[model samples]
Structure formats: structure tokens, C-alpha cells
Target: MPVQRIFFGWPVPAMPPRRIAVLLGSIALFAVITLVFTLPNSIPSGPSLGRFTDHKISLPKLPKTFSSPSILSPFRVAAHPPPVLKNTTSGDSKWYSNWNWLSPFSSSVTLDENRSLLPPLNERPPIYTYYDHTQKKAADLKAADNALLLTWRRAWWAQGFQPIILSPAEALNNPLYAELQTLELDSTLKVELSRWLAWENMGTGILCNYLVFPMGAQEDHLLSFLRRGKYPKLTRFENLGHGIFVGSKAEITAAVKTALDNPELKTAKDFISTVPKETFQVDPHHESVAYYDPVVVKNKYPKIDEAISKGANGLEILNKLIISHLHGTWRNRFSKGIAVLKPEPDHMSAAIEPAFTLAEFLAQCPESPMPSSCPPNRPKCSPCMASTPLKISTPPTYRNTSELYTIGTVPHPFTMAVLSSFRDNIDVPWIRRESSRDPWITALTKEVSGTGVSSAPRIIKFKEAVASEHGTFHTLWLTAEKEVPQDLDWRFGFTIPRNATDTGKSETPVPGPERRPQPKPDPKNGPVANPDDVKKERELLKRAKDFGQARTPAEEKLRGAIEAWNLADTEAWRFARAFLARSRVERLKWEEEEKHYVGGAGAERGKSSGWGRWFDD
Candidate 1:
């Protein structure tokens, strides 16, 4: 019988030790197998690929103005009230209401009405003007109304200025505005304190000469005339006329501060006297009507020298002769002046209407499928319009004058549009063409866009002023030379000095700042490497490594673009040189072939006529 173990109370058999050992061995084998499979996954591999890899890299914080971040900056942006569509009394809609459906992008949308669709980087500069509803004088009110209307028409519609019309109340919201309300002003004068405060708050260096439009008088030629001259501090009339004041954002803000701080100044001339003498230059073509004209004199005007003043800041003197004969002379040129007088009519309507439909504007845009290469045809884009209007269609006239070759518009409009819609602070490259100038050094004293040149300090100041309005200055380069200058302060923006082959090495140093002091020879180590030289080498190696070993998909794509841009720039010159070389070689080969054929023909003729063989021999 088999040995049996009693379950609860009986005797047990003791012959199973070998079987128990086998079972235990089997359990151990299974545990070992599980550990082999699971331990590799559970344990951290290495710092480069394990826990460290899981941590996301933190990019450096971008500048406040860099890449137009939509961070609601403390700096003020000029605002425009939405245009009223319906006429309260007539019950008829304005002309643009019907035009909403005629939009180029989509049938239901108007481009300007939806600011979301406008190009993100390079926006048109705002031209600030204002009117006071509480004015007691008819002439002052009418003058303000008329000046604002014509100014809007020419500045917005004709010249592409973004017009901003602020109210007296809007300006008074600033504590500084109330300080200005006490100064004396002429009955015909409309003080531009509102405009000054708005401009000061705008925190940009964009041209603010259009402020003159609302103050003295509006002229059809005034805006265009101002554009032709260097930014003038004051528009001089023949007889110390202080009717019109014009200047840059700096000049205007300074003058406004002077006027506000000085309460003793009475007349426009006194206020003008406080401004710097550098601003007091003669400009006969300034052409605004005389401040002491008969119409102005009849409106309770005082003698040129009075001691008491009453408006907000002495800025009331800014437009002592707000309306001139030009207002009546050119009144019908823009519009009937009826829409302007209406309290509800939209000032911005004329800007986006009849001159060119929003559809036409969109069609000519660089993002369009087939946009015109002409700068004038395309809507004003800062990056594309950096150079003068003349230089866009052709290369610069002078040799080595340097030209910024724009890569036209990138074709991925949908991606750009989406990104812009989200207001992402990403650096979207505006230009990717080979520059004859290195941009880094040129931007120090001259505009890379070829606007003009100035002292390095002044240029830097201007850049700082405008950087908030425009984005931070940056450039992408595929150098025509072997290396980028090591001396330029690369701290300004991103710089990737790459070659066509991507060899990640640079030989010849491009022209740059003076060499820094070289390291002294060491007794033991021979010589220490120059910091700049080492830095440059490290940069090249680092950039190459980063480019090749892009850890993520986004980085990989960005590197790909870098590669493409460099290749495109280099290939442009390479192909051009290759074409020229091949053409010359082909031409020589053709000439030789022709000579041989002629000789053979002559020999045949000699064989026939008996003189060809003698000539050949």
C-alpha cells in the first residue's frame, strides 16, 4: 500500500524530500526569470537617458519686446474704437458694412475689422489725433473736426498710417493730463494735450509728425511733405509762427513736458521759446497758414505777449491756429466733410475702403499664393520694406553698398497664421537671404534695412526706442565668407554661422572688431588659448552638435531649416559661379570644334580644287 499522511489526527509518510526540493528549485527558477525581465526596466539606465532625460529643458526668458510677445506689457498700445455701422437717423448702413462680404480672405470677413488677420511682425505706425466735445467755440470744434477728417483720410487711406483718435476724457485719465488743463488757450486753438499724452504713453519711437495735423491745419501735401524731410523738430512759418509743431516721439514728449511743467508761459510763442533752440529752424514749405491770420485775430485773440494762461499744460499753444485756409481749400478733396462732422461716423472706414478693397490688399500680400515683388504693390511690411522703395526691385546701385536680400514670403501661411493667432512669442524669421552686409556690425551705426546711417550711440538709442514697437533686431546668416566675426557682441540676437557643407569649422576670420589681447605664453603649457577664439570654436562645435543631435522633433525641424537656409544661400553663389565657369568652358569647346570643322571643310574643298591640300599642309 502507498504511504498515507493523516490530514487531521493520523500518522504521516516521510519519503517526499526529493520531490519537495525539486518543487522549490522550480519556484526559484521562475522568480529568477521574472527578475531578469523586470529589473532592466525598473532600474535607471544612466543620467543622459534616464531621469534626466525625463526633465524638460528650460529655455531662457525672452525679452519683454522680443518677438512681439503678447504678454500685455506695461507699455500702452494705442486703441481705436470700433467703427459704427448704422446711421442713427437715416437707418442706413455705412459703405463698409456692405463690403464686409467682399473680403478677400473669406467672403464674410473684413481684414482690418479683424485685426487677427493682419501681419504680426511689422505693423503700420499709429498717427494720434484728438477732438474735445466740451469746446465752447464753434470755430475750434469745427476746426478740430475738419482737421481730424482730412488728416485721417490722407494719413490712413493714402499713406498707411494707423490713425488713433482719443477723447479729452481718455487723456485726462492720466494724472498728467489734469495738470495741463489750467493753461490759457485761444478760442480758435484746440490743444493737443490728448495726443501728446497718448504718444508719450505709446512707448515707441515710431514717427509722430502726424501730430501736427490735428494741431495747426491739415494739408494734402503736409503728410507727404513731412516724409520727404529728415524728422524736423518744429515746422517754421515765415514770422516766428508757432502754429504747427512737428517732431519725433522724443522731441514731442520733451516739449510736452516743458509746457506742462512751466505754468508761467502764456502764448504759443512763449511756449515755443521754452523748447530747445535746435528745434527752431526755418521751413518755408511747412506752408500751414499764419498763426495771426485775420480769422484767428477776430476770435478774441490777445497781443503776442500775455502773462496768464488757462488750458491743460501750455500745450494749448501747440495749435493756436488749429484751422487754416487749407481746411476750406482742401475740404472737398478727401470727402464731403459731412461724415467727419457726424459724431458716429467711423474715421477708420476711409482707411480700409475704396482706395483698395481689403480683397485687393490681401491679394498683394506676401503670404498670397502669387504676390507681387514690388514693394509699393504689397502692403507695407517692416522686414520686407526695410530698404527704400527703390531698392526692392533691383540690387543696390553702388558696388559693396550692401543689400539685404529678402527671401520673399515663406509658403507655410497656415502654420504662420495659426501661430500668430495664438500670439506665441516664437521667433519667426522674416528674412533668410544672403546679405552683402554682416548686419551685426552694420546695425551698430547704420540701418540694415538701408533707411539711413547715424552715430552708433544714436542708432542704439533709436533701436531701443523702436524695439518695443518693432520686435528685437535679429538676423539669420549663411555667410559668403568662411567665418563670422568673432568680435561682434553676439548677445544681441541669435547667430548661427554655418557654411554650405556644414563642416562645423571656420578658417578665415571675416572683418570685425579689433582683436582682443591674446593669452600670454605659459612656462609649462606653451600658450593659453584666446577666450574669443575658444568661444568661437566652442560655439561652432556646440551648434554643430546641437544641430545634428536634435533630441526632439521640434528641434530636429528647426535644425533642418538651419541646414536649408545655409545650403540655399551658399548654393545661390555656388550655382552662379558654376554656371559662369561651365558657360566659358562650353564656349571654348564650341570654338575649337568650329575651327576643326572649318579646317576639314577647307581640306575637302582643297581636295576638290587642288589648293585646299596645300593650305591644310
Candidate 2:
């Protein structure tokens, strides 16, 4: 008999089966091993687009661990019960019962008040107020009888998004108004400069209409200033803690009147003043601050009432009609993607103002000198015309999803304000917190199971297998960024006990309403060995969620410590389960590959022209 060869601590068997399994297993294990890397979720994933689009990665079937809490639970705190005082002497062994307040484990955690990335409270952006101005040549203003009409620029005449108003000081200091006094102002400069003076935040309103809801709540206030507050009934309402609101003029007016006239409409003294009244007048007399009487003008003009009398249900619809008529309904969500919004000059400035607002644009540059002719308080160009709309490019899956959806027919603003611009005051975390846990778990499980896996760790590996595809989707939608680099990596985030877990098996049945027979417990594939432990985990996660939704400061501190403990425990759990899954998956995969190879080429190779065959020949 030939002496068996020893190689790398493994006896190279003369027999085919043992040697074949060992050889393939080693090769497969070496192939599957990879170095682990962790990164912050906020790290931008942009810089690669086409690569993800070209080659689609296949998602693995996730394990049952990825199920909804009703089916399976991973790791999460479900409810945060206030630690009730309990007697350790009672035979009960719940975690909260063994309270030694001085014990390090029982110590509470606190959020760092100094940890906020938000700007200082005193440094909030100034609430913008628009100045009222008149339409037609400066000479034509003297002919308009209604002083409110004098301040008003009729919808057909103004090309910008909303109505314009100017202040008393602004009337004197602004160079645009001073230029209106000049006799030689060219027809073009006259139009451009003249349009510049007629500023209203209509573009901002159109933008508000574009968001799904309260995202535009603050800017929506600017609309009240539009047209010198002619629509007092429409503009003066309290938008307290309810969802976003849209209604006919009568509805909003009634709501506002009740809030102002009746005390009951007030909820939580949170309502700041939002009375609607004119802020400017079109002096029939040549440029003078003395003629600015908003009350006298409004009582005479009453533009909103006139519109309603003409069958315009309310000011919102009136404004919305103008917007939709001029620009299409862009509020409907289109497929998500990359778009570069370039600002276009509004009709008012098309003949007069350059595509870029020279004064405002130049002022942005470092050490750039302002033109002597421009006023100390130079007027801003229209947000609608000057803003470049965010022309975004959608990824493959998101692209096809919106194919059947309708969008605005009118052209998009060349330069449109981005959602970020409106929400600059908001701050996000260094480690962004998870948004919706259920959706993410569902997504991961579906991929891991392919159709179903028995364990959580396998589901995770399956997640890694299709990282590029699903990872990209999560990064994009999760971070709220438009695109991320093709190679971008992501991890889960937590909000409180300094962080954030999961457990459970399905209690429900399918169509017949009968419970499916439970598979016999196998050491290799059975229910979790400790059922109580899973229940405890589920309870802890529920508590963490409660802490996350904590409205007050006291409850929030306990939540942080709980979150940290949960996260640490979860990671530890994942490591153990994942290691097991990795070993199992590797072994199974290797066996499969080995079987295929041996039955085809490897088996023949391992047979090695045996001496028997030689002798037979």
C-alpha cells in the first residue's frame, strides 16, 4: 500500500471522499473570509452612479429572523416601563426587580445637552417680510383710485410667483425705486429694474404647495404677506400640532376668525400672532412715505373679497390656479433621481434682469465690492426665477416605478429652492437614527430568505450578498440624499439608552386559519433554546421605542442608557448568530460546490489513475 502523504496537518487520504471534502472546504473557507469594516450612516454615499445602474447585484433569501415583530424579532426595545420599585425577596426574578440603586448596572444615563449641532437659539433666521409695490409704469400708478389697488400688481401683469410689497424705509433706500424716478431708464432696464421692485414670495408658496405637508409650514406664512395681505381671511390661521392643512378660503378664514375672535381655538398658548393686513400702498402721488395707509387701501380695494365674488372660492385656490395655470402641478412625486435646477429669469425680468441677480450673486463672492448704484438693502431676485430647480436623476428601480405617474405639464422653475434650503434650521445626528424599523427589517428579511432562511445570521449574510442594490436604496432614501457612491457602505443607527434590538415567531396562521404544524425541535434547527430570553428582548426593544418617542426630557435620559445596552447586546447577539450562520452557510455551500465538482471533474481527478485501472489495462 502507498504511504499516506501528510500536508498542512491534514492526512491526504488515498480514498476520494474524505480528501475531496477537506480540499474543497479549505478552498471555500478561504474564499468566503473577508475583513469587516464599519462606518457612520451619515457618511455621504455619493460619487458612483453608473456602476450600480449597469450591474445589478442579486439579493440573498433572508432568514426568518427578518420577519415583522409578529413573525420574528431581531433586537429592539418595545416599551419603556418606568422601573417600578420591587422587592428582591419576592420569588420573582425579572431584571427590574433586583434593584440596588447604587449598583453600576442600575445607573441611569443622560444625553449631553451640549451635544446639539443645532445653531444657537438666538441665531434663528430672520422672519422675512415682503414690501408691497405697484404694477404699470410709475406714471400709471397715479391713475389707480383704490390705494390698495395702487399697492397691488394684478396677477396678469406680474411674472414672478407671488405679490410684492415694500416698506417705508425700503421705499427711500432701495436703488430700484430711485431708478424708477429716472426719465431715461431704457424700456429693458425699466422692465428689469421695475420687476425687481415688485417682489412677492409667490415662488415660495408654489414651493410649499410642492412639499407633502408641514415641511413648508414656515414659508407658508410668507404667503400671508403676499399682495399686501388683501386676503386677511385666508392668511390668518393657527397651524398648530395637526398635520398639514389645505382648504378653501372660507374654511381657512373661518378657522382663522375663530382662533382670533374665540379663545377656545387656541391650543397650548403656542399660537404666535399671524394677523393679515396690508403692509404697503401704491401712492397715486409720486414716491412719498407719507401715503402708506394699508387699512385705508384694503377697505377700498379688498382684492380677496373681489376674487371670491367673481367665483374664486378662496385665495389659496386663486393663487394655486395662477401657479398651476402658469406652472404645472409639480407637487405629485415623480420617480426619485438627480436633477440640477438652473434658475431662469421670470417674465418680469426676462426682458430686464439677467439670468443671475447681479447684486445678490456678486455679494456671495469673497471680498466682492457692491455696485455703488445698488442700495444698502438691495432687493433679492425671485426664488422661483433665480433658483435652479433641483434637477435630480432617479436610479433604475425608482425610475420605472414613476413611469405611469403624471406630473406637471408646465415647465419646472429653472432655479427652484431645494427642500434643504427651507429646512436649514433643522439638524441631523452624527450617527443618524433609524427612521422606520419595520420597513427596513422587512426589506432585509425578504432578501435573506430569497424566499426564507431559518436563522437571523444567515439573513444578515444574505443582506451583504446584495449590499450594492439594497444598500444603495437604503442610503439614498435613508439619508435623504439624492445619490451615493457606488461603493458606499451603511450600518443601522440608534436614537437612545445611547442606542437601539429584536425576537419572536409567528403566532398567526394562513388561509385555513389553522396553525401550521410546528417542526419537531432539532438541535441544529429548532426554536430558540431560551424562550424567556427572547420575550425579555422583545420587551426591552419595545421600551426603547417608547423612549425614542419620549416628548419630555426626563423619560428621554433613561431611553439613552437602554438604547446603548440594547445595541451592545444586539451586536453581540448578531456576532454569535452570524458566526454560526457563516459556518453553516459556508459548509453547505462548499458541500454543494464540491458535489458538483466531484460528480463532474473533481471526482475523476481524486480517483488519480488507480493502480487497479493500470493493471486492468
Best by lDDT: 1
lDDT of 2 by residue, 1-617 (tens): 77888999899757777888999999877666532233445457887565769686778988766755744554554444443332211111112322221122222211221111111111111111222223333422322222222112222112112212322333334433553455343354333323223222111111111111111111223322331323322222222111112223343334333323433322323222222233112112111001112232134325534543444243332233222212211111222313111112111111111111211221121110111111111122122221233233211111112212211001101101111022111112311352221222222234334434333443244223222222212222211111111111001100001100011245465575446665454332112223454344334333333433433664444334333423322222222222222223323343355343212211112222222221121
What TM-score quantifies how close candidate 2 is to the native fold?
A: 0.21
Q: Where is model 2 more than 4 Å wrong at Cα? A: 1-171, 175-179, 182-194, 197-317, 320-562, 565-617
Relative to the unseen true structure, what is the C-alpha lDDT of residue 338 in candidate 2, on a scale of 0 to 100?
A: 31
Span of 10 residues, lowest total lDDT, candidate 1: 336-345
| RMSD for each of the candidates | 29.1, 33.3
lDDT of each: 0.33, 0.26
lDDT of 1 by residue, 94-182 (tens): 12223232122211232232121111122334544444545565554444344334333232322323444444554666557766666
Per-residue error for 156 in candidate 2, Å, reads 20
TM-score between candidate 1 and the true structure: 0.25
Q: Report lDDT (Cα) of residue 488, candidate 1.
A: 18
Backbone clashes under 3 angstroms, per model:
12, 73
